[model samples]
Target chain A: MTMDLLDDLNRAIIAALQENPSRTNKDIGKKLRVSEPTVATRIRALEDAKVLRVMMQSDMRAMGRPLLALVDINVEGRPPEDVATELAALDACTSVSIPMSNPDIFCNVNAVDGEDLQRFVDDHLSKIEGIVSYEISTALEVVKLDPRFGKLRGE
Target chain B: MRLDEVDREIVALLKEDARISNRETARRLGISDTLVRKRLRRLSESGLAKITAVTDYVAMGHTTTALVRVVSAPKVAREVVEEMAKFEQISFAALTTGRFNIVLLLSARSRREVADIIHKHLRSWSGVHMVETLELVETVKHRLDVALVVRDK
Candidate 1:
């Protein structure tokens, strides 16, 4: 099997799984119109390539981490990726991104409360070397969280 | 809403593999299959947890991903977000503080496609005052498998 065909099949398999994560390998193969073994091998390949993963996400309110904030950090001396990696190691961080825009690193964190979040900023984030400035934007409400990439363009 | 140790364990296992069988989960937790099923159903019913398949947008032919920061009038921030939410391409939307009133996550086939979406839908909105786009280089880490710790009463 060529790498191009495998990539396409993997994408299709991912799309199918995104629609329904609980489907078994056999069920997924049936839906994708591929042999079961082929599906299994392709899935294993994707998994090995780190292109696919199954994850469970809990509602923040239900889990007691009601305070979700997006932090934009500006680094003066060090590389943004290094700072991002440092920030990513924090337990509160959920997502980290290095964008080609203002504030070098963008991070999303789920904190226990306002005070906890403040302390995390003052103590943890502020102490990171080369971080020139940082801004925290508290989320009033997360209107949408998870998005279906396959159905993104209404296709 | 309080979760017991068993419930947390169940969530952790599901985080590892959403498709793990009840028997396998039961064996790992040293519990009965029936109990595992009941707990899972309760968790789902209570809206505490959900297992879903998600893909990296870049992997799905979406070569470009941008985080748009919209500055809206304080009075119209909520309204602008509502309008933004109507578009299906937006993966994440949040009402926020600081310089931007709302942040939107957009993924598309190319840089041009992202610009088209912004011009066609975003700028047209009356409430939008300023719009800034942050093109993401990479998602260094996205951790969804959070471990739940039971709180004391």
Candidate 2:
């Protein structure tokens, strides 16, 4: 796939989807004053190029999995990337990233309750051989979570 | 926001295909198109569910995305967060319990741009004592749902 530059119409369509992903291609074309086929073609191209993806995101708290914690793992005698990949294989691990600074690996995990969390740490997380120490930070509240693909031009 | 069986089915269908037509959703669930539309509208309006376009930062010309951890005095954590929210480069920001008061997900075209955000825009806050930037190598899995598969009844 070629590196296609995001044009104005593409940006407009993305902005519209960001507001309501369920909007039909015809509806978006009408709103943006573009042809329906053009809108459809652009949407397909964006998705194919990995630039745009539409997915359902259910609130974890609403789903009864309220415990969201960010764990910054300090790798002891092994490479951080391997440790991160190992953690990513776990079912409860939602996100795992190998950071190039501060802590070696940063992961976000969710649990249903305190006991579940304890089992996760003792049984799963700590048992990973290379992990020396980890700092667990519970997300108190989200100030902002703008999952937009990029700036929508003119902010 | 309790999701009924129909709601769960709608969610499961949408999770598989966000662009699925309401008529198709209704057909699959053996319900009327209007009910599917109504339920989707209610779910989105209540913030119980969201359908949005998520991009791969690297694929979008953004070479670097960093998780910046900010340490600020407890009294000024809110003030510090308010300042960080104004920058469009920072996508996710939250106050957490740990060594850092706020963690922000920032993406930029290059390392220099990321640096400018941290130095010029972010670190200028008087209340911010220390700012640590962690470059994200790869995201193994990132999703807002607990899991997409609907439980069998």
Candidate 3:
């Protein structure tokens, strides 16, 4: 379902949770002028529909994986999707995607340290078949990482 | 900022369901509710963890997502990224060390909007030497519930 199908109440509930996911249903209801059960029901529906999810996300920088590497892979013989699937299986890779442009596959990985990153490139990345060549860009600083993508009201 | 065993356990429980009550978590972990509350508070305060809602851009009508690689002039990469980060359409932006100096993830309703963002804003910026848009065709995997597995050194 698209954002247009989602009612205002649903959007408001999502916004409230995005602002602070730890807030209780009762608190959200009070803040949004709705009942606690209403808030809970809306959240359940949203989750059931695969529209949104509330989960704990750890800061990789604070969790020992301070290094972020963006890799663009050029695949030759094999399908880029197959190569991306292999890369996604690795523990360090957070996201893997097939782009519609020059780079066949693009992925962002997190490593524990410089040594760990080198090991990942040498061991995992190098071993993947069909990878003709790849370029790795290390992020110096993550200026912004706001994951809330369903802000319907432009908040 | 190293997470101890107890902290890891708490995070694991919350990873399953961030909305889980402190009392429920405490009962499951066989710890006191006060301790669970304290640990969560500490984690958030220390900027080590966050309990937040992550939405599906596709389901939200943002069907197009692209990774924009920007090659900015030397000494202005950070400034360009900071400015791009302020836009609501761009979800992620950072300065990198490679051929492209800055990388950004843009999500919008359609490819037209993504192109507009690239042409109207990103290209208009003064220091932006070159811009490349890699539209994400399909997301093979996006593990939002990442495991808190800290490798022992």
Q: Which candidate number maximizes lDDT?
A: 3
Candidate 2 second chain TM: 0.84
User: Across residues A8-109, which tens digit of lDDT does each residue of candidate 1 receive?
Assistant: 678788878877776788998888889999988887666555456665666666657888889888998898999998888988888888898677999988
Which stretches in model 3 have alpha-carbon errors above 4 Å? A1-5, A149-155, B145-153
Per TM-score, the best of the predicted structures is 3
Q: How displaced is residue B78 in candidate 2, in Å?
A: 1.0
Candidate 2: tens digits of C-alpha lDDT, residues A4-30: 448777878877987777788989999
Q: What is candidate 1's lDDT per residue for B1-153, written digit by digit as tens?
A: 578999999988887567678999999999999999999888877767777765545455676878999998788887777777767677778888788889998877889988998998888877788999999877777665542222123
Q: What docking grade applies to model 2?
A: acceptable
Q: Which of 2 and 3 is ahead in TM-score?
A: 3
By descending TM-score, how would the candidates be arranged? 3, 2, 1
DockQ for each candidate?
0.48, 0.45, 0.52
Per-residue lDDT tens digits for candidate 3, residues A21-76, read 87889999999999999999889888777677788877666556888889888999
Cα lDDT for residue A95, candidate 1 = 82
Worst 10 residues of 1 chain B by lDDT: B144-153
Segments in model 2 whose C-alpha atoms lie over 4 Å from true places: A4-12, A19-23, A30-33, A149-155, B144-153
Prediction RMSDs, each to the true structure? 5.1, 5.4, 4.7
